[model samples]
Target: MDVQAVLKLADELVFAKTGKHLEYLEEAILRGTIQGQKYSQIAEDFHLSEGHIRDVACELWKILSDVLEENVSKANVRYILERAKFYNFSTIGNDNLTINNVNICPQTPQSPQVTQQPQETSTQPHIDLGDAPEIFRFYDRTSQLTTLENWIICDRTRLIALLGISGIGKTTLSLRLIEQIKTHFDYIIYRSLRFSPTLNATLTNLLQIFPQQADIPQNIETQISQLLNYLRQYRCLIIIDDVQMLFCSGQLAGQYKTGYEDYQLFFKLIAEVNHNSCLFINSWEKPREIAKLEVNNNYVRTLVLGSLGLAAKEILKDRKLSDEEAWETLIDTYQGNPLWLELTASTIQDLFGGSVSDFLQCDAPILDESLQAQLDQQFQRLTQQELAVMIQLAKESEPVALPDILKILQLSVSNLVNAIRSLVIRLLVEVKEEGKTTFFSLNTVMKEYVKNRYMR
Candidate 1:
């Protein structure tokens, strides 16, 4: 949809709800989002502070949320507007809903069950992958890739999570997979939860894509019911990325931020309830409910992504390292994380003239200024407890018992346990089993990072 068309629809909705169209700055902010401009850029254009732009966005999202009866934010407002336009043209004022290519009207019985129909192009699948990131140079993750394909295409898994640390290629893998299997669904939508759009807002944006029923549900539960109804009626592949954004920073990893806690029930229902649709999430940290529900549910699976093995040599290849023999050692030291390799490769090239051996001779210093900057961003997201736990764990030469960690930190046992758990979730700490006990240790890179920053 054109940006102007979206704004027009938004204006109409806003007028209907609040008896006023969007103000000029609101429209500008909306336009900035539509154009994919950063708030900093938008602020510069408008002679406003980035914080002020955020305030404007909050107000705009709130107003749109009120009008649409769903949470609306800069990240998702365009999608909602586009889907609402489709609803307006096709089914909003009508009574019937399209179920598996059959239009069920007011007279038809609403059945909890649905029949599977052959894939046909008669009804176009409502696809709105809003600014889905591009697949740029994905390393070999063939087995994991195949698993994702089987889960979505053959097994028809309803909810699947792709879990990994940041820059471990989750986003790129998902993009490639979506392109491969997009035709299998009647509807395809992708949204980033990076900015923590409200679950209500996300639901509304998705609901706008489906054929609307005459009596619209106002509350979230009813709205979710309507979405479930559509999921049962049509094949939807909804991909939500960066789900960790919904989680609260500076707290336990699984806990949601205020007002986002409802997302737990939302995801739980999507996993447990019957629906012909699949919900795919790409996340840095696992949600609490996902951990519990995925235990016995084959329909729900979480794939943990580790560093690339031999394929990580691709980074060295790209960087044109002078010593090919040292690539394996370099890859191991950095755990084959593409982002880390990308950053480290450059530092190696600049300082050691692309000679990995020369770099290795220096003992692979873990905390380069650039890589430390990256770790800093992730570390900043940790709670005080999590950060303190990392500090103590970094000092240990080997995996230490929970009691050892407890001895160093001035925290109660429960709090210490929670902090360690949070650290584990953030992928900052690793667990080793010795005899019957589990011990905690920081990865080499993380140890250097925490030691450099906290100890020094």
Candidate 2:
């Protein structure tokens, strides 16, 4: 039962009880709920207050409850509706007809056409956005979306790696992309490897989405082969998120965990094999296979998501921040990262009454506990050398060149180069090129975090 079918039944039930159709807000709430979006997201999307949305949803549930003869809520509306649909068909007649175990009663000549079961057939793409985050408000990613759409629809890129720092909106951008171009593909499946599922388990989960899964192959090789065949047969757009979980935390970027090595092979085949499908992975660190694959195949691509730039002012605007001129300074301080700016905005709201300049007047950047905790997770994943480089950069007020870092850290040229390269890939260090000299630095927020947490 998809969202549209559920909505149709809901409208029918609502009209029968109230003699009127579902209102715009009520319909928006229902659609959002059915799609696993939160009430806050629904409110933001519809330009309504959260309290108003919640009140509307409460009234909706009460109305649905009265008609269904049971309690209905956001949590169980889908289940209750499905049960009601089944019950409605089963009680239609004394001599009931069953189709595929679902009772379909024979309609009399006088019965209305609405008594017939709705056909589920459609040309709409099969989209399974499993646990994808609801985008409350999409800041401008016009260029990014255009590039990704061109790659998938025009270039037919087989595999893409969406890389960015933590909370830089990689997942959000991908979800937005799916919304924009979902109709172009036959299948759209999103799965997260956040818990680090094994290759076999991941394959099984993905394969289950397709039909004829009554007897899945027991061998890993056969499972992979079957999935490849399906990918070739249909234009599937699969998004595997939280791919950084597949790598070892203590090692350098792109090094897989010991037992998860076979993922390397799986990804390689996806890039090399002939298929009319696109499989994109989201991660903080690029996979080891991507660099090599991009060189060998034009279809393999990588997009490193950067700061939101001027578009990020929308976030501050929603936060109701003051001192428009200071907004740019604040954004630059936080490097225009949506989540970072959001957290800092709350701090300003609480302590300075939404004055961005007041927050900036403090001796140092505010690294609230929540922001610190998030940065801690990213720092914890760095190697010792990377940590050393981060500490050195934190000590500098301005961007520093390579020779200065070498002089301060007393490290080998190759070691410094490797550490800086890894840090860049990790998106922790900021790089700037002036003339022929390259300089590196950390954003104000990160520099304060490193100083307070490590340089003490």
| Whole-model lDDT per candidate | 0.77, 0.82
Q: Estimate each model's TM-score.
A: 0.71, 0.72
Lowest summed lDDT window (length 10), candidate 1:
111-120
Cα TM-score of candidate 2: 0.72
Q: How many pairs collide in each candidate, listed in order?
A: 2, 0
Candidate 2 residue 306 Cα shift, in angstroms, is 0.9
Clash pairs detected, candidate 1? 71-200, 71-201
Off by more than 4 A, model 1: 1-114, 117-126, 211-218
Q: Report the alpha-carbon TM-score of model 1 versus the true structure.
A: 0.71
Which numbered prediction scores highest in lDDT against the true structure?
2
Pairs with steric clashes in candidate 2: none
